[model samples]
Target: MEINDLTPAEQQVWRAFATGAAVDFREEDDEDTAEGAQWGPERTVRATVLRALLLNGPQEPGEIAAVKLAGARITGVLDVRYGTSDFAIRLSHCHFDEVPLLYGARFRQLNLSNSVLPGLTAATLRVEGVLRLTDCRIRGPVRLGGAHIAGAIFMDRAELSAPDETVLELNHVTIGDDLWAPGLRAEGEVRLNGAEVAGSIRLNDARLDRPGRVVLDAETLTVHGDVLMRKVRTRGWIGLRGAHIGGCLELSYARLSNPGDAALRASSSSIGELWLRKGPPMEGDLNLRRAQIEVLVLEPEMLPTRVFLSDLAYTSLTPHVPAEHRLPMLERDGDGYVPYAYEQLATSYRRVGDDHAARMVQLAKQRRLRTTRAWYGRLWGYVQDATVGYGFRPLRAAVWLLSLLAIGSIAYALHHPHPLKASEAPHFNPVFYTLDLLLPVISFGQEEAFAPDGWYQYLAYALIITGWILATTVVTGVTRTVSRQ
Candidate 1:
């Protein structure tokens, strides 16, 4: 690290580090900032010299001291593990021969924008300011697990590729500000599991292509602000299971396709709001089982072929439509006949003052329950549904009562039954007699005083049985309705 051993570019960078002057090494016509024509020894700087300059840079009295170099070919590994630096490091439009090792290092800010590197291993790295990787192309994985950043991390327009391995790993990372990575193209998995971000996670317009695998696994990640992934196109799974978001989780216009499996799994997550509208029908399953959201903004047509919505609760639904229209979405639940999902939908409808639609959802829930019941139970359910729609359609009960009354009156009026005793018998009234026959509990003494012959007796027996069944079913339906309320 002697002054005499410094290369031409290194000598310029070393002298300029005290005053925080940026050393540009690019030709005038070089348009490609990342990897232009190869620079000779004149533009090459040893990583050891850069590391030494960063750690032991002379402080200027009134000027900021920083290492700012551009378009240089860094020769060796920039190993600054466990090192502490008071100055910032900005290496733009450069190429690194080896991955920079910044493990457990502390810095004010780190900017590697428009640089082409093999990889980066900065686990447990502590940065007081922003970490910029904008427009860079990384050929290998970038690991930042357990890192603490006071400022935001920007990876806008960056292309990270690791093929079958993870491209970006941010597990257990704590960010004081946002992690902005819009227009990112990652060829492998991007994990953010157990990461806690004080600000939002913006990955809008990103393309994540890891076919038949997990493209993004952000399980148990906690975000204080929104996690905006609008228009993100992913070829594999994007999981956010058990994640807690303080603000909205917007996935509007996203196209996620992972056939025969869950394309987006947000089960057990809690979010302020979830916007999944303005997208095409997803190619795979959308699992939101047990997720809690304040507001759910979804387009019904955007639902995938299969969905798992058991116990998923949302206080409000956008587009404020009838529950009947939303009921079809519940029907697509992978776990068939989830009563909680139906109840949640019904509650959402009721919140919107759509009581009729809420009742319809409840009715649908009952019908779905029938499918899971025993044969006898289903038969009884059919009876209730046919008579009164399980208390949801009270008009059906009135219609049934009127129809039965007419049939009974017509049958008895055709032929009067003989009286058991002449003294006890009243005048022959068909309507009163039919009423007595239909009303199993309250009788007008007609059924007790008279006895019918042959077919007439059988008809009377049938009426009595039908009357008792209708009474029992009506009571049951009414009890169910009252208990739910």
Candidate 2:
């Protein structure tokens, strides 16, 4: 474990490892406070540099290559700008502390993998070697393009920070191994365009912050591995415009808050969404285009909150679009996803005074399935509603009043307890006035009040009122239930 304990050959490899990773040949915009590394804070910045050479950077390859040397401590900047030494540097659980990298710093043929790399700064990097920072922090923008990393790369918990510039470019880099950057945090935009990962590329729980427009045009990029990004947070819209992914594109519980486009785009790619939340850059083919969520999709509204189907073809308005747009959504997705997407698109178009575009969706639906029931059902429901609205309860009161008068007339004729009173001085016939008229309203009350000779009109009056209430309740309940349904 001591720095000077390693043999002389191991010493050179350690020195080369330190030297190759230190000094840069290019100029950058941001000045760093990164100091040349040492073993520990107790050791001076000078002694640790020399001691690093003995542990892993051997002087001769014949000695270190022929034998196995392990547990190396590397200090200081190893400016390996095309350094000739091809050291394997394969040791698990080694510590990489405060190593300042060179500009255009290439990890070509060098392996400082499966180790702890904290407080590291590399501006422009080229991953030409098998790099493993499974739990490391390579803080800063990692612009590595056209660099062929020929071995498995592990960056599980790496933090990649970018310089303060308009764009942070990390495009077209090829990885020979599985590239993992799950839980990776980048202060600026992280671009991975034309990148090929031989193994799976996992980037779940990754955070990328870019104040301006950031493009991840990993189009034409091939990843032979399953692309995993679940619960990831990106401060900008993710662009995978024309990217070709060989395996499933997994994104679950991801939050994308870019003012421009969707948080993520697999538009031209085929993939999966076990649990996805895709909002947008106006309109693009999100995960809904390819896969289905085995679970649910959360908060699916984005930027403009609509997708336009200007490219859809139909029997009516959408007839202008190509037939491709009118086709069913991909087989594996949820049933209503595409229709909803189109629905959203139509809404957006309508807001901008595009009536024709709005009708395009309706026409497309008709072409897909012909049915008049929807329209008729609406009309039928409206008619029932009108019936209830137009019918007046006060009209029934008028009919009741007429019936009361008829009953009064009949009562006067039938009640002959007194003989013809026209000649009998109208015989104080007060019953003919109030009693007769009021009798019809209370048929039952009249019967109980007195014999046919008495004011039996009260019975009919009570019966009429009971009938009215019964009729009203029956009619009201029926109409109300129908309207609600």
Best by lDDT: 1
| Best model per TM-score | 1
TM, every model? 0.95, 0.47
Query: After superposing candidate 2, which stretches have Cα over 4 Å from the reference?
Result: 1-76, 90-129, 163-170, 215-217, 270-304, 308-485
- lDDT of candidate 1 over 36-152, digit per residue (tens): 337688889889998998889776799999999888899889999999998989999888988999999999999999999999999999999999999999999999999999999
**TM-score of predicted model 1?**
0.95
Show the lowest summed lDDT stretch of 10 residues, model 2.
Answer: 310-319
lDDT of 2 by residue, 1-485 (tens): 35576445344434445433332211232322133133333322232443233233434444433112223344445444332334443433333444544345444444443344443433345555676656444544444455566776666766555446423344666677888777776676566777778888788887767744553446566777577877776666677655656565655555566553454554544333223445233333333344222222233333234332222222112112332343333211233334444554455445556655555553344333322347765554343233332122234444654565566545654663343333533333334443433434433222333333445545445544544543453366456335523
Residue 295, candidate 1: C-alpha displacement in angstroms: 1.8
lDDT, candidate 1, equals: 0.90
